[model samples]
Each structure stands twice: as C-alpha cells, then as structure tokens.
Target: MKTSNGRKLSHAALSLTVLGALLGAAPDSHALGTQGACQDNHIPVALAPGLPADQEVFARLCLPPGQTPATVQLLIHGITYSHLHWDFPDPTGHTQRYSYVSAALDAGFATLAMDRIGSGKSSHPPGATVSIDSNAYVVHQVVQALRAGQVAGPSGAVGFQKVVLVGHSYGSFTSWYEASDYRDVDGVILSGVSHTIQLTSPLRVLVPLYPAALDPAFFGQGYDLTYMTTQPGTRYGAFYAPGQADPAVVALDERTKGTVTDTEFSPFAVILARPLDIRVPVLLVNGAEDRIFCGPTLSGTVCSSAEALIAAEKPRLGAQVPCVEAFVLPGAGHDLNTILDAQQWFAVAQSWMTRRIGAGADQTPGCGP
Candidate 1:
C-alpha cells in the first residue's frame, strides 16, 4: 500500500513539472493589454472609389471579452502614423500603461484601427490618387462593412450596432469629410485638430518633409516626391509636448513614422472655407499647448483657451451638428496619446463615448430644442 501511494505521488509531481514548463513556453497574453481575455484580428478590406483597381486597406480589430460590443470605434490615424498610433507600445514593458486600445476595451467598446490607403501595410497608390475625398470614401466603405458584418476577423464576421468614427489630425479631416458626406457613423470624435491652420505654418520649418525615396529607410517603396516625411529629430518638436513625452516614446515615433501625400495637404487649405454638414454628435478634443492650431502665430487672433478655439470653429461647422462638445487636455501637445497625461485623454474619450454612443448603461441626453 505504501509503494502504490509513493508511485502515485511521483506521477503527480511529474505532471505538475510538465505543466509549468508548458506555461513558461507560452507567449505572455497580458502583452496585448487584456490578459488574453480579448480578441485581436488582422483584417483586410478592399476600398471602393479608391486609387483605381480597388486598393486594399489593412486594419487591426480588437474586441472585448464576452458578447460583442454594442459600439465599435473605427480609429483613423493622422499624418505620419499608422494603426500603431492607436495601440502604442509601452517602452517600459508595462502593458497597462498608455494604450488607447486597452482603454477602449476596458470601456466595453471594440476598436478597428486601420492604416490609411497610402500608409502602413495598406496598398500605397500614387500620391495624387490619395486625397481627402478618396480617403473619406474609404472610411465610408469601412463603416458600411462594420454595419453589414462584412469585415471578417479571426472571430468570424463582426458587426456592430453602432459605429463611431474617431480620427486624429489629418485623419480628423477625413472623418469630417466622411460624416459630412456619407452621414453613416453614429458619432464622430476628432482629436489633434482644429478648423483653422493660422498657427500651423511653422510646421513647414519644423517638419522638413522630403520625399520618402530620399530617406534610406524607404529605399524600394516606389515613393514619389509627393510622398513626404519629416527629417529625423524633427518629429519630437513637431508632435510631442515639451518635456511631456518620454524619450523612448519619441524615438519609437521617429522609427515608425509614415508618409503624407501631397494631395492630402491641399484639402486642409480649403476645409475652413467649406461648410460641414454633419448631423451626428461631434466631439472635438485637442491639447491645450497644441502649437499647430492654437499657438501665438496667428497675427490678429486670440485662442488662449479651449472655449475660444471651439467658438472660432463653430461657424465653419454650420448650425447642423446636433451636439458639438470640445475638450482640451492640459499641457498636452499634438500627440495627446503619447504624452504624460495620455491615460487622462483616454478616460475622457471613453467617458464621452459612453455618454454619446450608448456603450454603457446611460443613454444619450437628447440635443434639446
């Protein structure tokens, strides 16, 4: 009887040792910021009215645990950014720090972070073929796919009851166009942007944008002069807030920065003149110290605060938008998600999302007459 008991104990010990070994070899699920509780899928979507021949846009779709989320955020990155802009990698190896994806998931919302047609893994058509109008059409198709369950992820065809279009900088411009023309999204969140470019002229000096072909990093990408990027050591000043962003994070920004097409620039010049016809709830958020839009460069203007900036923009948006809310993060810069108060920005966005898009139990208070 003693020998049998000894044998059984030995067998159990061996099984435990093997299990530990297997667990050690497994990839860290927490690296994805959800402790392996969520789903991440790489989605390939074809764009219509694209740069001819149907260009393909790649995106990363992240879904929270349990049942599908009621609202999905389609995140559009700004100039010189990709899907990574939404899910920034923490240089300190802390998965819980400074990730918009983690914040959205915690707030019970799914995220679809897409690379623009001329950036990241998406098909890079000729620079001239990629414009604000073309990108707006691309965004419209993506929204349609989300509503119709046409976007197939690893978890199978995924659809959402409500789709919110979120954008930063140039992406905000495109989102504005999408909501204005298609009026398909349930809500729109425009970050790192303002209606005016009065103080942004210095950007030409700060960002010495040269042809991507001239840069050694993009040797064989077939880039023309129209595809441009900032010179090295320029992004830190142009995007990050003074003494707010981590050096390592700034380095990552330089390494992963993408291209901006010439055609994308022309649209910005005319945006202030064009009237926006959006009928959905619109939220505009920017950094308090955003040098690009709200700086001292404007000769005959004063935008010392968020209220002043929003008031300046009210006329360009027309009187059609249902509810237009604005917030300015203190001490943040153009890249609000990478600065010291990044989590604060995320929390504000999620709170606003819950209030406006039905992500939480609370219903949206109507825009009263």
Candidate 2:
C-alpha cells in the first residue's frame, strides 16, 4: 500500500535468532533478545525537491512476545548515531539494563527504531538534499505507514493505532517539525533538546566535524564533503559527560558513529522561529549536564533540576500546548542512552507514558487530571 505521500513502503527482515547471537543478545522478555519478533526494514520514502524519489529508510521493528502492541514508539536517533541510539548493545554481556527498546517491550509497547534518510543503513542522498524539514517529511510518512499497516513484518503487514515519536538531539528537532506540521502522532518524547540552548556550545560539535570521507571511520565510504562526522577521539568530549559515561560505550559509539549533512545544520533559526501548535502530550528530557543546552546562568536552560528545566521550556512551548512535561537525567550529558544511569530516565519516560497516554491504542493522549 502507498503512504500518504503516494510512495510504497518496502521492508525486509533478518533471522531474529541469528541477529541476537551476532549482537550478543539473549532471548529474554525484558531484553532485546530473540523471544520477540524483530526485523530490519528498508522503507521507501520520498525525499525533498530535487532529490531522488522512493528513497528507502532503514528501521528495526521489534514487537513483544505473545501479542502485538496497540501503541508503538517510533525511535529517531540524534545526528552521528543510528537506531543503536535506542538499543545500545552492551559489549559487556549486560544488555538487559541498557536498551530503551528492551524496556519498552517489557512494558508491552512495540518499538520501531529508524535511521534518518541520510544516515545509517538508509539511503544516503547528497548531503545537500537532507535538512531538518526533509527529515521531518520522511518521519511523517513513516508514521502514516505505521498507522496504515503498510509496514510489513515476519507475520505480515502490521500497524499501530497509536504512535509516539521518541527523539534525541537532532532527531528531536525533526520531531518538532513533524509534530507541529503533521500533527498526526499521538505523543512525543524529546531528549537532549530544548527551545533554549547555549549558543556557543554548538561550536564544540561543528569545529570537530570535517568531511566524513576523511575520517578514518568513514575512509573510502564514498561520502561527499557535505557529509560530516566528528574527528577521531572526539566523541567523549562532544557527546558525553566525563566520568558519567562508560568508556566501553564511548568506544562502541565511535566505531559505529553516523554522519550529519550540511543542509541539516543551516535551518536552526528558522525552525525555532516557527510557532508550534502541537496539541498532544509532549515530554521533554535532558541530561543535567547537557553541554549543548544546560548552563549555570540564564543563557540556556538551568538543568540543575527537573522543575527548573520544565519552567524554562514551558514558556517557549506557548499556552496553546495542552500538556507538556520535563525530566532531567542527573549527571548525564547529551547522550543519555549510554550513560551510567540511563535506565533511570527510561523508567521515568515509561511511567509518564502510562499515565498520560496509557497502553490502549484507543486511549486518547493527553494530560490526566
């Protein structure tokens, strides 16, 4: 079946058992194991103007054992990351505690973690062809496919009556546009992002990003100069907080890092300037020490406490928003998934979802009285 934009959605899956063994994951209901059905899918999406049509978006869809879920969380990674952002495979054989995907599955929610059009296993159009707007368009199509049962799985075509967008960093920016423009999703969970930000902090990321082709990680990978990645040995400083992140996770992150396009970087001011009219339940999460958006003074958000962060963001979201919430992961940085206490925030999100949106697909997403 064709998506709302008139493009067909295509998908493929690998053997779940084989995938589990390869990633050192075991079969467990509370872990990203082989018990549940999981597939790596390539979904066709139309790109922005002047780009090729029918570009495929790569996603990993995992449903819980015994029954299909009525509600699904569509995971979008930050720049320089992949679907792994949501399901970080623990290199130490302790995968049970680290993955947000696993936690959601254990809570009876399906999860679809996807790579944006220009990153990970997805189609890499010219870097100039990718932007926050274009990425948002792709996400909207994916949401429609999920709701329409156009995304095929091992059992057959599967659809969710409710979809919640879960985004981190740049993914949160894309979610902002999608939730505002399409207003199709049931809920949104945004992390590592806020309307207020430390203006000078972005230089810490931009200064280190050279052409991905030149980075030893992407050498001979055929990326254009517009495809950007951090210099080697820079992930720890740029994305994680010292002494709060695991070194092993940082190493794995560097080894599997993704790219960001130049086009994705140029539209920040315009996007923030546009008014948002999202009418669903919106949750904002950030690391207490997020170097990009947290600071000591009022230049950016005061992430010292959750209440403070909520106060900082509430005014920016406008009175039109019905229900908005915030959480701050203490001692963590921008990359919340790989930090020491990552699961703490994951639990917070899960609990919040249950309270606001509930588990039933027919449940309307809003603030509970």
Candidate 3:
C-alpha cells in the first residue's frame, strides 16, 4: 500500500496489534517501588495568548520514596508521541532495560510526565489551536501548579521546591520557549532535537504524512484532515538509526505513534528562531545519526560528529543560560529514549540534573565510554 507521497504502508495492522500488546502489559512494577508514589493526574490549564480556550493536561507524577523530593523533573513528549514515550513499557518485562522512568526513579528524582494539550489523553482541541507558544504557556502553568502544590495527586495536593523541564523533539522546542519566557525552571534537558534542520527536506520526503482523519485509527475523534500523521512503516525509517533500534521497540513505536497539528508545523520556524534566554542550566542531547538535525544533508555544512552537532546549537542559545552541555548518543537516531541504550542516556541526563539542578542521585560520568 502506498500513500499520495509514494511511501509504502505495510505492517500497519500488525503494528497496531503490537501496540495493543505493549499497552496490555501491566505498568512497570518498579514505577512506584518502596521509594515513592507515581500518581496520575489531570491538570486543567488555560491556553496562552494566541491559542484557544482552556483544557486539561494529563500528567503522571512520580514522587520519590520516603521523603519529598526538593526538585521534580517535568517531562514533555514530542510530535507523534505522548507521556508513554517517557516511561516506555518493555513487552519483555525488562524494567531496567526499557524504561527511562525507572532510571530516574532509581536516581531518586521525582518525575511529572505530561501529554501536551493536543496529544495523548489530554483534551484534543482543534489542530489549529496548538502551537509552540501556546504549549509553552500550558507547561508554564503546570510548573506554577507544581510550585504552588495546586495539582492534586492521589495521596493529596503535590508540590515541589524546584522543577526541571525535560523535552524531546517538539517538546524540546516548547521547553526552550518556556525557559526563555518564564525562566521558572531550574534546568532544561532537550533530547531528540537541535537548532539545525540540515536534512528536514529529505525527512519530509521520507516521512510522508497524511491527514489524521484519513487514518482509520483516528478517524472520528474530532480530528480534522489538517492534523497530519506519518504513514505506516515510515517511523522506523525516519526515527531509528540504521540497525540501532531494537525491532520490538520500533514495532511498538509504530503502534503507538500519535499526530502532529498543521498549526504546530507552520509556526515552527518562528518558534525555533526565538532565542532561549534561560538563566538556568541547559542540556542538549541528540542521537549521533539524527537525520533531521545533524545528518550530512546540509548543502554547505559538515556535522559528522556529536560534538560538531552540539557546537552548531551552542551559539544560538544566547549567553544568558548559565551552564550548557551537550551529548550525542552513539548509534542512536531521533528517538533517543526508545533506542537500545536509552538507559545510558537517562543516566547521563540524571547526572547532569544532579550536578546542575540538585535533583536525582549523585553525579556519575555517564555520557562517554
């Protein structure tokens, strides 16, 4: 089966079954061990200046065991993903191998994984109503709620002394927008994204997208044809580096892939152009073979290594951010969290958070070999 863009669509039905299987598995037993509680919450927040009316954002707060954590990590997923991306369930039941939430829990940090307004279980408004600025406002409100202890958890109202915003891909862009304007977060960790789009055109060619309404999976949920989604079987090609991601993980991704609003893509340049005026520590993590951001497709540029990729983005962040660090995960692609060595990236992020934001476990040099 081929779409209008000529991309083949195979194994979509099989992928959907794979998704069901993964979702059917019980939540990780380690998600809330003796150390802390993981509470699912729906937070109502008003949209930002240029967006639509208020909506409820769905989030799961993972509290540290025993004592209240002074700092919390607020997680945001990118295009075509939800909170599930943060704590991906391994079909094989390997807790330590497949989950970033597990890694963070082991490191003794609280995590609040959220689904953006238009994605996941969060309220699905019109596609035009979601943008980077508006999503940033939603995140800012969530941060305020965390600080004020206004968000109601299962145990009770929950709050944190410090908050760090962690985002992947489009989520990273939203994080940059939040830290730039609100400056409320203690630290920011951006994964699966960068300032450059060297091969964006090629990526567009490869991942041919169609209307969400056209997809049989999401036809009648109030999403119009304007909401775009990648054709079946394209995710692995676009997101996973060659021979890097596990076959099972890739199958799960195809099954659970979400949608991207046209509004979100149109205003992306405006969002990316804005300078991040964050005064807190910032970390940028990208896959070494990321096709969109750091691949060898830029007409006149060379970004063949992780250091070169990070160097391209450093100057764009501006000098206001106090400390900035970058790590490129070897043999990974755009979806760093789902790759085989995702735990290693999580360790690196935890280390950075501990050193900069005073959250998580003691610092360990987890980036390099």
Candidate 4:
C-alpha cells in the first residue's frame, strides 16, 4: 500500500479506495490530527541476517479516532533518525509540542512508525550489509507483520492484541534485540539506550559521523561509504541539552537527518554482553543530560534521577523482565524527542503505556518488595 500521493494501491485497492475516506472522517480534530487511518506499509523484510525476504520496511500505520486499538506502538527511530524520531515535524510553529506521534495519538495508541532498514522509507541494503542482527531481523519481520494482520491500511489489514516495542537511540539497540530474540512483544520501551554505555561514549558518538555520501543533507542521496551522517553544524554538539535545545529544533534536526550503518556500529559490544532476556513490561526512558548515556565526558551511568535510572538499570534486566520502569528526561539531551521538555517525556511514555500495556488486567505492579 502507498498513498502520501505516491499512489500505488492494492490491499484490495486500499480496501476499496481509502476505506470510506479513512473510516468516515469527522474532522474537527487538531493536535497533529487527521483523524484515523494513516497507512503506508512496505514490509517485506530481510536484507541481511539469514537473508532472502527481498527488501522494504517503511511502515507508518496510525489509527485512533474511529478505534481499532487493542494496543500497538512499534516506532523505533534513532541513529540519525527517521520515522522522524517519533513524529516531530514542528516547522517552526515552535516544536509541535514535541510529538511522540502526537503523544501516541492522544494516548489511545496504535502507532507503527518504522524506517530502520538503513533509515527512512526503508530498503537501503549495502551499508556494510546492515546489522544489529539485521535490525533485529527487520524488527522481527515487523513484529510478525503486526501480529499477522499483514500490515496493510486505509482501514484494512489491522491486527494487534498487544505489541509495544517503541525504542530510540540506534532504536534502543533495535529494541534490545527484538525483545530479547523474539519473544514477540507485549511491552518494552527503551528510549535513548542504556545497559550502561559511556566509555568515551563510543568516541563521542563516533566523532560526528561522516559519509552519507558526504552530507550536504545527503547530497545526491545515493548513499555509500557505509551510510552515516552528522557533521554540518553538529546538531548543537551532537544532539542537544546544553540550554535545553530548540534553535528551531536544532535546525530541524539538521534538516531531516537519517542514515547510520557501518553494520550498525559493530554489534554494541556483543549486544552488551548478552543478558537482556526481555520477557516484557519494561520501560527505561533516559536523557537526564545523556551525553550518550549520562555524562558530559565519561562518568559511568547515573542519569541522576528516577532513582538513578532504576539503580543504574535494574541489574541488567532479564529475570523474566516483569517490572522495570525508569524515566529521567529532565533537561533532555541525546535527542530526547527533539527537546523542550518533549511533552515532559511524552507524559512519561504515555503513562507507561497506560499502566503497562493498556486496557484492563495487566496492572504491572511488579518489581516492588
């Protein structure tokens, strides 16, 4: 499916052409609104890790005002961002209240947002043949095509009995290896990453990257030299926080930036020495001045609050990951969703996605004594 006017339809011609104008529109909706149905799939993953699935990943999904929400968030965006780092357009109307997809569709939830296959509008292939387990096996094939409804849109192909994932910074290391090697999500958020990383903060985020075919905002855009980005105006010192950002959202994040590959930075030290079982119900936020995981230089991990980031990340999460919440945000950095308090960290991640995976019976009050 496709329809941001590029026009190639079919998911039965977008369920009989725009499914009754995207489920009978009743328009007075404003905060980043256009009411329901926002389709633009692509899907077909696998361009690496055990290859052969062809390309595409793109995503988008949406859905809210006109229901169809049994819970779905997905998202991802990070290293040089796309899926516009969770919907941040802000064309100088002064930070559209820092949209985490308009605060997760005003908290009703059903988001998607992808583009991690070598960033935006997916499929880029040869940037050292992408990795981080091929972007966690292309987000576990878009989380089994959003739980087998096959990811279509314009009101067709919907499916989700619960899926959370979220992510950020290197898409939070591809959502901690796709929820710890595909247990198939039910909840997990992550956000600017941390299982503790700050030793020279990966050489200060790889010393302001380089080749997105030599960034003039991706000139000629045929990307090679292993993709990458960040250089011109160094996005207010590699990603805001000093003076809590804004400069027109750091020049519209160096004009819609996206790209990062050299095999996704060498597997983050063997996936942080393997041990994030990720059973579900996890949160993690960050950016309490996160100079690549808290520290302006090199000071180990302690984001200063939220009980010092869940006592420096709850003993490296895994014991069936039942309750792991952590937030921080404060004077944001590490691109905390384009700063300016970012809707106070998207209301603490949509109130922990409505008390641990929305709608009834999963209260998630674990991790206490």
Which of the numbered candidates is closest to the native, going by highest TM-score? 2
TM-score of each: 0.84, 0.88, 0.85, 0.32
Candidate 3: stretches off by over 4 Å: 1-36, 49-53, 295-306, 360-369
- Please give the distance, in angstroms, between residue 190's alpha carbon in candidate 4 and its true position after superposition: 0.5
Error of 4 at 147 (Å): 19
Query: For model 1, how does the per-residue alpha-carbon lDDT over 1-369 read when each residue is reduced to its tens digit?
Result: 000000111323333432433443322222343421333333344444533435677666677767777688999998878877886655544344567877998888888888887987777888897888778888888888788887654457767778898999888888888989998888888888776654555454335678888887678988888988888888877777453887766776777778888888755568646678888887788887776766443443224565766676656665788777788787777788877688887988898888778763245433433
Which candidate model has the greater TM-score, 1 or 4?
1
lDDT of 2 by residue, 54-117 (tens): 7989877788776787888999998888887787756544454568887887777888899998
Q: List the residue pairs that clash in candidate 4.
A: none
Evaluate all candidate structures by whole-model CA lDDT and list the values in order.
0.71, 0.78, 0.72, 0.72
Per residue, candidate 4 scores C-alpha lDDT tens digits across 1-369 of 343312222234333322332333211111232334567778887765676888888877877675677778888887877885676645444234766876887788878888889786788878887878788888988888888888876657888777888888778778888888888888888877776666777877778888888766567868788888888777678767463765755765676677788778856678777777887778888887777777432343578777767776767777777788788877777778777778887888998888767833344323443
What clash count goes with each model?
A: 0, 0, 2, 0
Writing each residue's lDDT as its tens digit, candidate 3 over 171-285 gives 9989988988988877889887776776463445335787878887687888876688888888877777553777777776777778888888776668767877877777888
Output candidate 3 Cα RMSD.
8.2
Candidate 4: list runs displaced more than 4 Å: 1-58, 62-69, 80-111, 115-119, 122-165, 170-188, 202-204, 211-219, 222-309, 313-355, 358-369
Per-residue lDDT of 300 in model 3: 32
lDDT measured at residue 368 in model 1 versus the true structure, 0 to 100: 38
| Candidate 1 residue pairs in backbone clash | none
Candidate with the larger TM-score of 1 and 3: 3
